[model samples]
Target: MNVYSPNLELARMVLDSQPFSMYLGARLTAFGDGGATLELDIRDELRQQNGFVHGGVLSYAADNALTFAAGTVVGPAVLTAGYSIDYLRPARGEVLRAHAQVVRPGRTRVVCRCDLFTVDSEGNQTLCAVAQGTIAVAETALPEPVE
Candidate 1:
């Protein structure tokens, strides 16, 4: 199955603009047609005390994936209004992946759902969490990028 979006380059640029996303090494691997996928390699720093991937990391992926999915339909100037995530399992793998799609698209707001997964070395993916979010069109433009 083809997962890449035609707008991958533009979406990746937007993802790279976020300091936190860059810090986590997250990549916008796919985006467009009201869907998006974010991926991050698992690292020692992203683990919890028990050795599983941190919940916050998963939440971050979900939130960003949801917003990106919304962006495919609502355009670039958008913000995540709010979101809720349910952790389904402990994530222990080589990489973390979040796939999201717009549940509903609107002029002023968009609803999205995301599924978080952990991919093992052998390419097995385990569902770790699920999320739903509401994205709103930004009333003001985003600030200029820092030089």
Candidate 2:
């Protein structure tokens, strides 16, 4: 069976419209062909007591990136079913980049892997975290428009 797919434009629109995306100050930097990249600045608010990016923030960004990557292959109806995250190093930098790629695209599910990197002012990137997520298509009934 053929699966649904969403182009970069539609993926960006859908991601930007999400409330959590606004809350996290997440931006869809790039999206295309079963892949997606998101960027987030490590402002004071997003840092922990040690002046490093918070773990939760990295996880959130990674999750969103993976979801968007899966959406590129599975379309807008897809929803994240589960995710596993691993923090390799502290994210201490000015910005964080989350890059995701679809590992497997199936009829009903899409599996994605993401790498979160901390980029310094000098453009040095350090691998901070890695995540794997599974997204599955969801079916929902839409209400008819009222006249």
Candidate 3:
């Protein structure tokens, strides 16, 4: 089912206002009715001592993707209820890409799933992690923070 987006531009603005996503260099590449895709570059700053991308970084990407996917159907005020991720392989690549989709959308909650991949310079993608999460529509619109 397709629903009208209250304000698509507002979604982008909200994402840009996220301090953590900005700090991590995450970019919202695509947004649609019930899905979203995001990308992040793999830089030395994002790597752990073991030289692999940090688990937290992957989790962050997954979490954001899930929320964004839900937001497509629930509106930009959606919040992540909870999420779980499984690391399938060590991440090593030039960039990271996350694809998220809403499995179910409800009046107040949405179930989402996301797949995180490592993309090489050649454009080959390797699945590194998977996530499942629930997103909830906020009770009310929150005011923007004072900077």
Best by the TM-score measure? 1
Per-prediction TM-score:
0.93, 0.88, 0.92
Give the poorly placed runs of model 2, Cα more than 4 Å off.
Answer: 1-5, 140-147
lDDT of 2 by residue, 55-75 (tens): 989989988898889777766
By TM-score rank, best first, the candidates go 1, 3, 2
Question: By lDDT, highest first, what's the ranking?
Answer: 1, 3, 2
- In TM-score terms, candidate 3 sits at 0.92
**How would you encode candidate 1's per-residue C-alpha lDDT over 18-110 as one tens digit per residue?**
899999999988888889999999999999999999999999999999999988876777899999999998999999999999999877789
lDDT of 3 by residue, 32-113 (tens): 8789988999999999999999999999999999999988887776788999999999998999999999999988889999
Worst 10 residues of 2 by lDDT: 138-147
Overall local distance difference test of candidate 2: 0.84
Clashes in each model (backbone N, CA, C under 3 Å)? 0, 0, 0
lDDT of 2 at 100: 95
